[model samples]
Target: MYGQGMSLRFGVLGLLAEEPLHGYEVKTRFEEMLGGTWKVNIGSVYQVLQRLERDGLVEATGDRGDRGRQAYRATVAGISGLTEWLEDPDSQPQLLREDFYVRLLLLGRQPNGHLARLLDRQRRVYLQRMRDLADQEKIARERGRPQVALLFKGGQLHTEAELKFLDAVVDEMGKE
Candidate 1:
């Protein structure tokens, strides 16, 4: 099961690809990078770090921070893993299956279900998310973080796309 931990492991590796960091720095940076949409727990970060170290994906640099926490950097193996993950199109299914696809399946099972109504509500949520992302992007740009701003803009675009999809679904269900 490549479950929750796998996602976090990859996220950690991706962060390490930029620079070395301790567990706490990883957690804080991840939260900041995602604009707080994904909040990571320190304990889980430590657990993933230990597993990454054990797997030789990352190595302790024998460097200690002001707080005395050990810093870790991604190894060659970790960089290779990150590259493969980035290039894999198969990972899309794992992402969609857990959220949108599962919701779609379970929502369809109701005997008297109004799928159109479900879709409409989802569209509203996505629209709100898009607005939020836009605001975040503005802040990122003002802070001179072009990379983070680009990420937020991408999320806004994707949410806009989802709204279009929901509209199509609503229209199709109306024809049923």
Candidate 2:
């Protein structure tokens, strides 16, 4: 399941499209699929499953595990929703106002804000992330995982763009 403001509702639905799974199994499998890059909380998964069920996108199979946990599967509406979501390729505008942008905007509003220091710290963090992603990309390539490598490459490009945007901001701030 997706976090607040995250546009990954389709992700949970997509997994359900394959087969039915309980909340715990959904959490485990989602975390496994992403490796260590992301952590999907069990609570969030359950909440999303509940919401899906309420929306008629999924339904309880009435099949329970040995522990009495119920399993859920995608419905026809879920499949249709997933397909429609996947086919619509436009970026969600809400995502553009990420925390980093809010941080920068707030910092700019403060007359005595240590903008340079903040930018320097953020740059270091971004550089470290870029390094980590590069390492992952190399490992994925060595393991002959083209799909994984492609995902990493996309992340790398995004980080690179962020770095460039940061530099431009720093330059403009220097002139002020």
Candidate 3:
């Protein structure tokens, strides 16, 4: 998963690479940076911070913030990892199994009307998500956040591709 949306660690590293941030700041900045596409819990952020600290990718700044929260900054190795990850082009699927593909296979056993309804519902959801992405993209552009806008654009493109695949599935199902 070395694509734009890699694991949360890289996101955390990228955030820290920009500047030091406390656990709470990391969580909030992550959500803000990605235009709210990924909502990470505060606990998860702290856990990642601890892991990053243990891995020597980050270190405590020895500065206490509000409520005694310790701030952390990315180390040189962390920045180097971030650079390497960005330069890597390996976007191969880590897992051979995809949940949606499995669900589609199961749905193949169902009647046409049932499968049609499910597909329709999914299409509607994708459409709504595209709309949301558009809105987020606009907000990001207005806020002068080009990276966030680009992220939203990627989401829009991916969702459009999914919709096309769904339509192709419906067409193939009709052939049977």
Top candidate (TM-score): 3
User: Model 1, poorest ten-residue lDDT window?
Assistant: 89-98
Candidate 3 per-residue lDDT, tens place, 1-176, comes to: 35534578888989999998899899998987777878998998998899889999999999998799899999999999889987887668533365776777788898657778778888999999999999989999999999989999988998898899999999998799
Steric clash pairs (candidate 1): none
Error of 1 at 135 (Å): 1.1
lDDT of 2 at 41: 77
Q: TM-score of model 2 relative to the true fold? A: 0.85
Count of backbone clashes, every candidate in sequence = 0, 0, 0
Which 10 consecutive positions of candidate 3 have the poorest summed lDDT? 90-99
List TM-score per model, in order. Answer: 0.78, 0.85, 0.86
Which of 2 and 3 is ahead in TM-score? Answer: 3
In the range 15-88, model 2's lDDT, one tens digit per residue, is: 88899988888887776566447787778888889888999999999999999999999999999988887776
lDDT of 1 by residue, 57-114 (tens): 9999899999999999999999998888777655334446447757777777776766
lDDT of 3: 0.87
lDDT of residue 160 for candidate 3:
97
Q: How much is 141 displaced in model 3, in angstroms?
A: 2.2
- Output the lDDT of residue 51, model 1: 90
When 1 and 3 are scored with TM-score, the better candidate is 3
